[model samples]
Target: MIDVVAAILKQGDKILIARRKEGKSLGGYWEFPGGKIEEGESPEKSLIRELKEEMMIDIKVTEPFGENIHDYGDKKIRLIAFWGEIDSGEIVLKDHDCIEWVFPKDLHQYNFSPADVSFVEQLMK
Candidate 1:
């Protein structure tokens, strides 16, 4: 199973989301910034590494907001989500095509991965 971490970053009433690049799994879908956990790394460390690689920013990952598990065809993932705050640097899209700040209630407007949809639902509750 893939151990993944997602950052649920908020600025007041809005949260940051990113659109996956074309040709990637769940392409065109929007998701919170995160990636798979590397071997021997803690979830928080993995989140920090992913944010730096994908968003070019330093983030302070907080305690997990929640966790979700889902299967996508050939693979299953265990998602560990955290509420984070930006520490430095602007959000420069490096891996994703684009990024947006969205309200929690308005998250359903865009398409999300099956697993991510559940994560968002948990956030809304």
Candidate 2:
């Protein structure tokens, strides 16, 4: 299974979510910003690097939030999620079509990637 990491970045009462670029894998679906973990990298470090690469923002990863493993017929992924906050830099999206800061209660309104649905349910609870 491919290992991935995602950041649930918080700013006040809002959480940051990004829309996958159209035509890409899981295109048009909203997800916690993150990417696949590279070789020889810890999940936390991978998340930090991914935030900088994908969103152009420096993040301070705080704690583990949750994880889920899902199969998409073509592939399986283990999604490791963590809590984080922006440390610096303005978000300049490089991989996403859009980004939003949404309250937990409103997260259900967006169409999220299937691998991320469990976390969304936990947050809504």
Instruction: Give the top-scoring candidate (lDDT).
Output: 2
Clashing pairs in model 1, backbone N/Cα/C closer than 3 A: none
The 10-residue segment of model 1 with minimum total lDDT is 116-125
lDDT tens per residue, model 1, 1-125? 99999999988889999999998878888998899999999999999999999888999986788899898869999999999989999988877898888888888888987788987887776
For candidate 1, what is the lDDT? 0.89
Per-residue lDDT tens digits for candidate 2, residues 1-125, read: 99999999999999999999998999999999999999999999999999888878899999999999999999999999999999999999888989999999999999999999999999999
Candidate 1 local lDDT, residue 83: 96
Q: Which residue pairs come into collision in candidate 2?
A: none
RMSD of each: 0.9, 0.5
TM-score of 2: 0.98
How many backbone collisions does model 2 have? 0
Candidate 1: list runs displaced more than 4 Å.
none
